[model samples]
Target: MTSSLHLPRRRRGLNRRQALAALGAACALAPGAADATPEAARKLLGDLVKVAPKAGKVKIDVPEIAENGNAVPVTVTVDSPMSPTDYVRAIHIIADRNPQPGVASFMLGPDNGKAEVQLRMRMAESQNVIVVAELSDGTAWTATREVKVTVGGCST
Candidate 1:
């Protein structure tokens, strides 16, 4: 007696190279995959920092070398008087090498007490990461740091 459950046959006709090419095409067409490139980060930064004149008093802290790319710590600080009159409105973090370069964005208010942010994110390789801050007065400030990643975490 033969089992009715028959598994699908593997495509032995396709060579390794062809299979790899097909996989690459599929990955490129996948939603969110194509947008996970460094270019996306650039676009995001440009949109967030539209009015360059407003950018000032922003600071970023990043390690020179990240031992692990899976979780690198980042810190951002802004010089502002956390009051209703003048306060940090938001902070944006972008990693150049990561698949999703747009790491995080934090929205702040006067109640935050201070214009500071800290978080951990994944890095794909060695590249510049930018941090931008926006204030209630419609001013923006940015800082960048080059982070070296020993092992890439975005890709296998």
Candidate 2:
């Protein structure tokens, strides 16, 4: 007896060239797939002009214990007047355990009223989240927070 339900099937007809191309693409992404580590996080920080950013004047808000790994709330606030002369230039959020350490970055101008940013990010595992704020005066400040995750997000 044939059932009335129908299901989609994957196309598996691939020639040698197509198979090689697919294999090459998979190989190309293999390294990047496993590149997320503490060292990767450090590499991202090192790429910045100021790797050794001082810790101060910035507050990073993240849940101390996150049950869901996906869509974790993150907020970074800088203590600044946000005047034309003094304001936050950029804010970089880093996730130590994500597929890529560089989670997101927000660029702000003097016209922006406040030096604060709020967004959501993903966490792979329990790790420290770092926030770095670059000011118009060529100064960078950073803050770090450890978050515990019950389930993993990326590569899980």
Candidate 3:
């Protein structure tokens, strides 16, 4: 099966070495691109979109203790009817202590039949994770979980 990776495409002009060099140079220019912070995340999220979320009706699943910080499994579920009249619109995962608070985002619809998402998240350190769900009816739900990592990920 030919599946899309959903990764960024390499720029047309630069070769592998040149691309790597350019990427390195660009990262150097962007402050904290190597290490994202919660404040940075707040600013990032604030610029991306505004959200007012309520509590409950959502569940976040992650290990209480992660032996490795490189990759931690995370799952989010929302209690929704999954019908055209009532369905989930999107899910955004945030890590409180990680350099970048925003982790992953998923968009869903009635065709999904359920509101659920599973993915692996790289953590910089032990931190609390928050998941915000947006519904088609213009309502938002949130849930949070804390995970302790023995070792940190990202620029380790």
Candidate 4:
């Protein structure tokens, strides 16, 4: 009997450079292409959560000044009972000046015991950082803090 060998199939998609070029073109043609400022990011966050204001309780912990922008520590804490009836459903972190304003989004459950999350991320420049918390009761709360970066993380 003749031995049969199998070869792995190559991915039929654009390579790295081609993918980047496609992404750049898409971003250039997207709406509000010139409005990637901090204010715009905040407004986008507000619209995403679908909350006006004064809903749940949220807080953000971060240093006022960062020596390095490559990795800044951030923590979000929500004041909620975390019971079956009421609990924090999700937490979203946004870095204003980053190429992608949306930094991190975390999902929580009552088993988490506490509504808190900590992470380190890169920041493009000095700007306001927003933290939004969504509760099980369909309410959302937000908090923001300005962070000064001595060194830039994103490309100039």
Provide the TM-score for each candidate, comma-separated: 0.73, 0.76, 0.72, 0.73
Candidate 2 per-residue lDDT, tens place, 21-116, comes to 986455335456576678888789878647467889999988999888887888889999999999999998888767678888889988888998
lDDT of 3 by residue, 1-156 (tens): 123333233333346769779855653445554545557655655544466778898998889999888889988999999999999998888887665567888999999998999999888667788888888988888888889988767454
- Error (Å) of candidate 1 at residue 63 is 1.0
Error of 4 at 145 (Å): 0.4
**Segments in model 4 whose C-alpha atoms lie over 4 Å from true places:** 1-35
Worst-scoring 10-residue span by lDDT in model 3? 1-10
- True lDDT of residue 141, candidate 1: 80
User: lDDT value for candidate 1?
Assistant: 0.78
Candidate achieving the largest TM-score: 2
Top-lDDT structure, candidate number: 2
The true-versus-predicted C-alpha distance at residue 79 of model 4, in Å, is 0.6
Which digits, one per residue and each the tens of the lDDT, describe model 4 over residues 4-89? 22222222234666887985566444454455577768777876688764644888889999878888898889999999889999
Please report how far candidate 2 places residue 95 from its true position, in Å: 0.9
| CA lDDT, candidate 1, residue 28 | 50
Model with the higher TM-score, candidate 1 or 2: 2
Give per-candidate clash totals.
Answer: 5, 0, 2, 0
